[model samples]
Target: MGTDVQVLYFGILREMYVQAREEHFSLASGATVADLVERIGERHPPFVPIRERIRIAVNEEFAASGHVLSSGDTVALIPPIAGGSDRYCVVTDEPLRIDPLVDAVAGPGQGAVVAFVGTVRDENEGHEVTELRYEAYSAMALRALNSVIDRCEQSARGARVAVSHRIGELQVGDAAVVLAASAPHRAEAFAAARMCIELLKQEVPIWKRETSPDGAEWLGMRP
Candidate 1:
């Protein structure tokens, strides 16, 4: 069978493409991952970022930039992650129920519940932030979040968790996110909650935009 070529896009690049994935473009007999990126970027300059930091995969396994791509290969553009807040009562595009997460973690044996809520601050770095905006590739974002939650569930000692995040234009002090975890012991809850937030920030596909005194700009993940 002939090889098929696919183009994957993510992050701000998606905003430019206005779609999650692209299905056009095929290898001419033979093509490498780098060749595909060059063709795409030549056709779509915004794909430059994808060329810079994207991870290439054949099928599902990670490949190098120079890897040869076969037909029917599924390529994914993975973006750097920004941490989600450490707070319970988290909100995303829609509202979330905190009580359920609380119930999931509570136990007669567990003693303490630790929760964190992240609010959009009016100020960032030095300027006054008028509002904040959050955007995501919803399907991927939710999947990544669920993955983090599942991992935490295995490690937390009877921990229950709740998270909520806000999307669209959000004013300062508005709730951007919430996380809560309960464990048999306070220490475990605290640790679990912290880990959850850290993992989310590092893995989730959510990005933030900040409107400040000067203007608006997208926020990047801290190294």
Candidate 2:
């Protein structure tokens, strides 16, 4: 008999599995997480190269390589937590705002605040992009975003961080994401801000589709 399980993808994995966020797969009874990973790698050749680097979580908790998977199990592939305070992480349909997030992370003792804003571009790969449609698995995205904030806070040693991502259709020049970091010094704030954005791009479950005169296509995972 086979055990049916739900596989969830984030970051690069989500881009690789552009069709859906949750997928159903059946494996032999008593299969381990490693077995499932091998099956996925077989189906998606790109996953093979980075197999060792991939992390697994079962039922919302990190799982070891030998963890046994049961029927109806939920499996998530976590890339990494690269790198917060009132540390805010959110995914909303509302437009992204920077001032509030910056204020949210700022502390009286902090001397520096750094913010990063990501906006939709008018062109990509020679195509004149008309707009961009962003989508995410809300629950997972929030968790991943929070994880990134936590990492940033840890790396900056008490630095505060805030991040907000906008989802749904967005016109060119619209702010798609906003991140802010505050620390006792400029160096820590800048480093935390950079780490937050990089990790968010590499770990969050958010996915973007570009619409252009040529049609629409999902942007692939960043290398």
Which candidate number maximizes lDDT?
2
Report the lDDT tens digits of candidate 2 across residue range 70-93: 998988775433331123565766
Candidate maximizing TM-score: 2
lDDT of 1 by residue, 58-131 (tens): 55455677787777787755433333222222224433334444644566877987767778887888879998
**Model 2 TM-score (2 dp):** 0.61
Q: Each model's C-alpha lDDT?
A: 0.65, 0.80
Candidate 2 ranges beyond 4 A from true positions: 1-85, 221-223
Worst 10 residues of 2 by lDDT: 79-88
**lDDT at 117 for candidate 2?**
94
TM-score, each model? Answer: 0.55, 0.61
